[model samples]
Target chain A: DTAVSQTPKYLVTQMGNDKSIKCEQNLGHDTMYWYKQDSKKFLKIMFSYNNKELIINETVPNRFSPKSPDKAHLNLHINSLELGDSAVYFCASSPRTSGRAQETQYFGPGTRLLVL
Target chain B: DQQVKQNSPSLSVQEGRISILNCDYTNSMFDYFLWYKKYPAEGPTFLISISSIKDKNEDGRFTVFLNKSAKHLSLHIVPSQPGDSAVYFCAAPCGGNKLTFGGGTRVLVKP
Candidate 1:
């Protein structure tokens, strides 16, 4: 069984269009995050939610939003997608520990977004 | 600015040889560090981790060494196999639920 899974493994959209990627984790983790890997293969964190609460918001644009309805799911919605948005979107989950952050994040297969 | 950096973009090793992947971080606030391995078409998987309190952590054939003073960390894989070929990433927690990842190093283990 896959611990973390994402829908629409591949997404091809056009500029000025909007799209959403869904992520779900069965590991019962308390924190979920979204990361973007550009063509240069630089992985950077975009957003993070702890128990459905927005905890960490990176320098991502306002056009990108992350919603976590519950602890098991976190979805990313992009508005007016641009060509620069062509990259791999990865969803990750990790258990929250007391005081110290020693948890290992588990990542999903990732959604390859192609903006044409 | 990128807090974490992997200077080496790629490395090649022969079977039964040791593979050493290095990483460096500029942030002193990071208390925990981790190494993740990724194969093509798949997401990165956690391999090993080392806490700031400890300088070294070993798990079977994989060992992680951290030097807080130098802000450097390295993952050593003993007797690397062809199956060990993949992209390895170094990561550190920037804060609550936020992890800063390195540029990644692709390791190719040949037979």
Candidate 2:
């Protein structure tokens, strides 16, 4: 079974449209995160949820909001998607009690989004 | 400014040889560093890591060396195999949790 899984492995939409990407982790992790990898291959953290509560949020646009209904599920919703939203979005999770950052991170296959 | 950087875009090594990849960070608060290997169309996989307290950590053919004072870290692959060919990225966790990743370096292990 996949430790971390994401829906809509590939998504294509036009600007001004709305879309969402869903993610789940089966690893019993308390901390889950969403990252965006731009064309330059820089994976930047957008948001993190700990037990369904937002913990870390970078300077992401207000249109890009993340919602976590439960500990295992985190969904990202983009309003009026822009062309710059085209990139690979990855879902990752790790135990919140981890004392060390060296702990392994479980990542999903990633959802590729394209905005025209 | 970029906090974590992997200046070398690529490195090539013949099979059975040694391959070294370097990374540098500006944040001293980063107590742990990690290396991830990624293939085309797939998410990155954990390779290895080292804590600030340790100077080096090794596993099988892979080793991670961390110099806390210099805020530099490097990954060494001994007996490099073609299967090791992939994009290697170095990352550090800031504020105790959120990870910041480097741009990544492509490694090619020749057969």
Q: Which run of 10 residues does model 2 chain B get worst, by summed lDDT? A: B91-100
Each candidate's DockQ score against the native complex?
0.78, 0.71
What is the C-alpha local distance difference test score of candidate 2? 0.91
iRMS, candidate 2, in Å: value is 1.6
* B97 Cα displacement, candidate 2 (Å): 1.6
What TM-scores do the predictions have? 0.96, 0.96
Candidate maximizing lDDT: 1
lDDT of 2 at B1: 60
- Model 2: CA > 4 A from native: A101-103
Instruction: For candidate 2, give the lDDT of residue A8.
Output: 94
Write candidate 1's Cα lDDT for B1-110 as tens digits: 88999999999999999999999999998889989999998999999889999999999989999999999999999989999999999998776667788999999999
Per-residue lDDT tens digits of candidate 2, residues A4-110? 89999999999999999999999899888999999998999999998999998999999999999999999999999999999999999988664774256778889
C-alpha lDDT score of every prediction, in listed order: 0.93, 0.91
User: Over all chains combined, what TM-score does candidate 1 have?
Assistant: 0.96
Clashing pairs in 2: none
